[model samples]
Target: MKHPNDHYYLITFQYLGFRYHGWQRQPHVKTVQGMVEKTVNYVLKDKPFKVLGAGRTDAMVSVNNSAFQLILREEVSIDKFFKALNENLPPDIKALEISKLSDSDSFNIIQDVAEKEYLYYFTYGEKMHPFCAPFMTYVREELDIEKMSEAATHFEGKHDFQRFCESSDSQDDFVRSITTCVLAENTELKANFFPKKSYVLRVVGKGFLRYQIRYMM
Candidate 1:
């Protein structure tokens, strides 16, 4: 239940997940949420607050855009808070925007999401430059791109994805719908150190179970 004094805000941020364990806060481990809350606490000067992420990402998985909900006991100067939040956050993480949420607003970050898109960048045959390790995956053997592309289409539409997900005993439903799944030549990201030829597996869905994308790839 929300306290009468509680002030709710929705914050959008992005992070390079290469260094953090994941999004959730865990004991004695660095995570995106851990760092974010730490910085928030610092900026708020020990003011009571709570944060909840829209969703969690796996270790070493980077995000171009993501968000979280922040609940505070006291209101803040939005411009000053936004500026300070970005300045204090680590270089790999950035605060994009912050907006106040009214009490009557019907927004639940976790449940209201329309869809999520994931891009798996990769290259094969030749080893990638060391600099590319953080952003791209490397496969030692040459891959049959055509075959992979064709196979990606099979995952489109609603289907039981139990084989592709890591589920727990408490969870029985494994069905998921894929609005888009395609493999294509990489044109989205370009770096001078990146390989001359590369590819990306783009997957879009309402939700994904843990390790589903990794297993699918």
Candidate 2:
């Protein structure tokens, strides 16, 4: 059933975050939210709409899959609206799926999300191809894959990640648990620009403090 006052939509999309400043919109800054909202406004033909992201991603951080909650003032053809969004959004941003949201859900994506998975792709040793900059981090230093893999295990289980995250509120609980933490070969994502061999630091948890993944790498 639909709410009488509003229409809620959940849009799943992916983007290459290399050129964008970040997810949130800011005056005089290029941001993912800015681009998305601009395209949405154009597609709606100036009809009023609001967008809320499931979470925020730092600049240059690419996500394989992510979502945003869109609340439209008026009802629209889901198929038509989905296509219009894809047609207007930039090539770097792609919409994968769209679904109607129920009133009972409260249209709150952040609270609904139970866990998040992050993959930090990197390649060590020789310099990486310039084209790979957006998708992976290049490390010139020789990394001991064996040792790194072992050390990654230490991050498993519960611990205070206060040192790993960048937090303005120091009094907040920094303790968190890692359901999965591993340094593994990059087989999930492939590209012609990718190196012959690449690695990815995959982390999964209920939540993560700001910049924790970057600090881990």
Candidate 3:
């Protein structure tokens, strides 16, 4: 339950999750949420506040854009806070936008999310430069790109993805919808260190279970 005096703000940000242990905070491992909360606490000077992520990502999975909800006991200057947050946050994480939400607004980050897109960049047949290891995966054996592209089409549309996710006793619903799934040449992300021939597996959907994408790949 939220107090009547509480203020709500929507914060959009992006981060390189290569070093962090996914988005959620855990007991020992470093996480994006943990780092964000630490910076927020520093910025607010120990003021009472709550942070809720839109969703959780797996370890070493980077995000181009994502958001979270910040609930505070009192309102503060948005511009000042945003500036301070970016200044205090680590280089790998960036705060993009911040907007105050009115009391009449109804926004639940998790429930309200319409869709998400995930991209897996990979290359095969040759060893890649050490610098490329962080952003792309390399397989020693040559891969059949044509066959992989054909197989990707099968993942499209609605289906029971129970086998495509990590086993969980708490989850009862295994049905999920995939809006799009495609394997294509790596045109979206390019670098000099990247191999001449690389591919990307793109998946778009409303929701996904834990380790679902990894299982599918």
Candidate 4:
């Protein structure tokens, strides 16, 4: 064991966001960060440490990758800690890696993140399976895939999307860079109606402001 003063870790992870509230701690809804703290503390048998995340993702928005930092008083083998963590962590949130980060009084992912991506899935015409219930959005009317695809192309590069973003949880700076946004037809896509078209919208960017995907689609 090492002195607690110098010990710290930068934790990287990914999760399925369907089961928990957005990242931040809330009164009622469970949160990803909350679960990580509780499970880690459980591993430590109640040793307390502060859990800090780079950015807080809203509910139903899955994280393909993310980072957080925690300071500790003791040194622990990374492999063993991760093994125990995987055992304690729920199916939704899984620790991908643990690395020591340079000591800094303050850490923020927003400033350091080079790029980020958000994928939104949807199908029109019919429902293929219940498994996609969480990610798939079924539309009552068929959206022109070509038109939508063309619209997506229009979003590439940086643009002021204030007019496009939905009217929920809006904030200043609607300008967002769209490195790539496209609509592609899903094969053999099924829906409530017979023989129809289906498509999924995949958008990648430096970052998304908020509800930007819904507005783009």
Candidate 5:
């Protein structure tokens, strides 16, 4: 049941997760959610509201597109709120859009997600610029790109990923189908400080276990 004065809205945004610990709010720590909440409270003059992220990102993991649900004790103009929110949010974080949500929308972020894609970027043989640390992992050891590329296919299809995941028993199931798993030359993300040659491990599936992607890399 909806509360008398409560309203729900969906906010889409992106953030560079390097500075913050992660997306979740924690006491006495800088976090993406904490920054967002602080800004919201500031803009709304300390109005009561709660923010719920669609998913949590690990430290230093950037996101291009993500969403959060905002529950407010009172209604507010989305246009004005969005404008104010963007103005107050940190430079690394940006609000892309805002939309009102209703009971009939049939959207449950956790359950309705059809699939998720993860890209792990890395450059081998040399240390990358400090700026690239947030966007990609640097590997000092030399790697056989062709061999790694072929091995990536082994992770495709369904198999027991117990060892690759953390706390396998925490979940009801261990088998996961990686619809797309491959290693290819890095082309998706570009930066002036990035290495001339880099590769990315692309993985896509219905769901992922905690730290599964990192372990796979």
Candidate 6:
């Protein structure tokens, strides 16, 4: 059942995804949601608050284009929220955009979110950059770039996706649409420090199933 306080707001933010366990604040460990919620309370001067994310991101995953909504007692100032959010939030988590929700009074953020986007980075070679190891998962074995590209096209449109999704007791419908699917490979990004190399595989899509990218690579 949906909560009575279903009012929603669209929050845009970026995170390192390295230090925390994941986006959802689990009872056991550090997480992005835990940090964000703690910050919201801190900025509000020690008042408890709640929030809803489009979905949860698993451990060791980062997001540059993440969206969520917060339920707070005090009125939120967009500019002030943006500036102060980072103050209480950890260095890894940064708020980019905060759009006060506009919809029916009972709109549920989880159900109302239209879509989401995620990108995974691949780094090759021996010498690694400071951020590379933490930010990117390493792949040295030769993967069929052309084959990966072909596979990406297959993922376009709708699919059962049950195979791609991580098994969960909560997952009911495994059908998800891919609005935009693209695979890129180039040598434009040359390292000035270590591992002077080129990326052979890249992918961007509207939505992703759990460990879908990891499964793909």
**Against the true structure, what is each candidate's TM-score?**
0.97, 0.93, 0.97, 0.82, 0.91, 0.80
lDDT of 6 by residue, 1-217 (tens): 3355544457888898877788888998999888888788788788646788878887878887777788655566778877888777778888887777655365666676667766655655564667566655566676666666776777778777787768689878777777655555545544555355445334454456787656655
Q: Summarize candidate 4's per-residue lDDT along 108-173 as a digit string, tens digits.
A: 555777777766777776644666665567776756787778878888999998877654564677
* Candidate 2: residue 199 lDDT (0-100): 96
**When superposed on Cα atoms, how far off is each prediction in RMSD?**
1.0, 2.3, 1.0, 4.3, 2.0, 3.3
The candidate scoring highest on lDDT is: 1
In model 6, what lDDT does residue 68 have? Answer: 75
Better by lDDT, candidate 5 or 1? 1
Residue pairs with backbone atoms closer than 3 Å in model 4 (clashes): 4-73, 125-191, 126-190, 126-191, 126-192, 127-190, 127-191
- Residue range 145-185, candidate 3, lDDT tens digits: 99999999999999999999986788899999999999999
Per-residue error for 182 in candidate 4, Å, reads 1.7
Query: Per-model C-alpha lDDT, please?
Result: 0.93, 0.88, 0.92, 0.76, 0.87, 0.70
By lDDT rank, best first, the candidates go 1, 3, 2, 5, 4, 6
- Model 2 C-alpha lDDT per residue in residues 1-217, reported as the tens digit of each score: 3346778899999998898887888899789999999999999989978899988887777777889989887989999999999998999999999999777366568888878998999999989899888888998888999999988889999999989988885468999889999999999889887899999999998778888989988
Model 4 bad stretches (over 4 Å): 1-6, 103-107, 166-170, 186-198
lDDT digits (tens) for residues 1-217 of candidate 1: 7788889999999999999998999999899999999999999999999998999888889999989999999999999999999999999999999999986258888898899999999999889999998899999987999999999999999999999988899999999999999999999799999999999999999888888999999
On the 0 to 100 scale, the lDDT of residue 79 in model 3 is 94
Lowest lDDT block of 10, candidate 6: 194-203
TM-score of 4: 0.82
Q: Global CA lDDT of candidate 1, please? A: 0.93
**Which window of ten consecutive residues has the lowest lDDT sum in model 1?**
102-111
lDDT of 4 at 40: 90
User: Each model's number of backbone clashes?
Assistant: 0, 0, 0, 7, 0, 0
Q: How would the candidate models be sorted by TM-score, starting from the highest?
A: 3, 1, 2, 5, 4, 6
